[model samples]
Target: METMRLSSSFTKYSSLSSYSSFSSSSSALLQTKSKNFISLKSVFPANSIPNGNRNLTIVSASKADDGPQQQQHSPFWGGESFFRSVLASMESVYLNKNPTAKAILERVHSVDNNQICYDHLAFRTFGVNGHGIGSMANFFLDFGYTQREELRFPEKKLKALWFSPPSLPVSDGGSGVNGPLPRIFISELLVDQMSPQAQEIIRKCTEISGSGNKHAALASALGSLTWEKPLYSEFQQLARESEYAAWTLVNGYAVNHVTISTHHLKSQLGNIKSVNQFIEESGFKLNSEGGVLKVSPDGMLLQSSTVADSVSFCFSDGITESVPCSYIEFAERLILPQFKNLPEKEVREFHRRDGFEVGSADKIFESTSKEQLTRRA
Candidate 1:
């Protein structure tokens, strides 16, 4: 086994209180009118049709074997093309709502003209009335993504799964103009495990305005809350039991966080620690719950995220309050031991650590927690 190591200087700096806190009141919410239903026509523009039949290879690491395996997929069609639009819309919605993320992307662009590559796009949902991972997974599954391992967070009453994307050539089906496509990480609150009172609050909201399986993905792509505006009291009640539930109550099916793959950055920012330092130096605060750098027990996967921004939400009672909104995340998947001997140029997505870590992700989930959100204030 390879020894886990990180820069001593980076570790020391990460432990210090160097980030500046911003007043949440100064941040304005990018509010949109609630839509009863999001039409597919709105998501799929006329020009968004498939240009050509493109064959792609899907890669998956076999748990029963040492080396990675590849499977040939059929020619690309409307699914892959439509997924691109979905991603574009989700990113647009996220950037429009998250100024902090927009500024960070601008900074990256200023440094290098290269487009940012995503590690994964995360979504949070409630597990009730056909509104959980199954609703969201179908969209990605239709796009040639494969379901991977399941991760559970007993303490948070949450369960999540990460999906691997079909690897296509740069011009064909990757995330941006270059690099590999990002994985999808969707987590749902374990509603049944919550207190009866909290469960009732969630049940009422979903029952009143839940988007059935048919339109769940559309609602997510539009970044629309499928449910009616939640009451402040209900939000508080859920927050006391499970902060995850409270977050989903207001920001239903919205992109929870878009993770930047630091290793793919191929620059000084490629190092996870260096990227965290740059983010803090650039004036954004990171989630410091388990320190800025969250590492897996084996240390191959390292992650960090900005403290979630505050959004001005109008409650059901017509009272507006600043609540936690989505934020940005950074991840660095280190090269596996077997791949360490290979030339740097030969390393591919499979060469590095894949999937997610429960321990690291558990902390990453706290990006939107009140404790982390308080840092923004």
Candidate 2:
């Protein structure tokens, strides 16, 4: 299967592989809000990560004398060992549902000297204290990621926060090191904002999961459901109001989708239109709410995604029906003409857009809605 073959553009930009080599010479003190609760501190030296034009660094904030405040370097999270585990875990689940992605991964590795490029990974959660966005963010924050931006969708009763990964120093100049790390978008359904019946059902699911020692489960934001399954009637009711909440109740805090940056694929597939055409021609249906492409106001960012796959789940009543599971997304960010002439560093920080567009994301969230899935079916 000669699926989308990532050009050297993606192969050369994998900074996730760089955290392996750390020097003992330079190290920074690191601490988390609750070191005892979440063991996030690790002692590793600063090393370069490969991201075509992006670099991810993990450090502790420190005050400097003459120059700007320097990022006191800390140990990389999980290092290479943990890095491989994380990718493997995510790939296992993502590939299971998205054969399209599996084909692409196999194709890339078949040629050797290549790896897939991930524009971003998104997770859906309930808007609860220790179990929602705050808890999910901790997982990434432990790995040196910091919150960058927040977005809201009152109509959908949802709120999202985007996190940026650590970056390498300017002295460690390399291709694409100027760009930021692959984003991690975490959104939580406003359960309290839902109808009383909906809220009670969600609360019950959380209660079931919290019955035992949940402290250990807080470390990870992905995996199989920790709560009891809902009755078909309850699930339908929740889905009727907010599919996102119903998804979390059944699927728990798992990845909703992984985004691919079409801009990076330009060398291989060209523009967003080309990418969408290729996927559609390959037999995948795209989200049509805002059309196949959702362009930002300034026309700098464009987005699209495949309709969620119909995954069947058995209700407590012993009935199974297929509903939306997960999907793949594509994003293309245009460089401002003004910044196009500037150096790559300036362009990365000032020109290329970061974060999500409210209207675009609002529709993207519908990928898993019953209406979208039924229409595609």
Distance (Å) between predicted and true CA of 197, model 2? 0.7
Runs of candidate 1 exceeding 4 Å displacement: 1-79, 172-179
* Candidate 1 weakest ten by summed lDDT: 1-10
* Residues 1-377 of candidate 1: C-alpha lDDT, one tens digit per residue: 11111111111111111212211122232222212122223111100112232221212232313445432321222223334555677777777788887787777655644546788889988887777776676666544466666677778877776677654545422323133557889888888888889989888977887344445666766777767898899999988988888889998888898888887775677687988888889889999978889877777888899998888999999989898889989988888777689888977676677767777788989999888877552
What's each prediction's TM-score? 0.80, 0.72
lDDT minimum window of 10 residues, candidate 2: 36-45
Give each model's clash number.
0, 15
List model 2 lDDT by residue over 238-266, tens digit each: 98888887777677765688776666542
- Give the C-alpha miss distance for residue 28 in model 1, angstroms: 47
Cα shift from native, residue 137, model 2 (Å): 0.8
Residue pairs clashing in model 1 are none
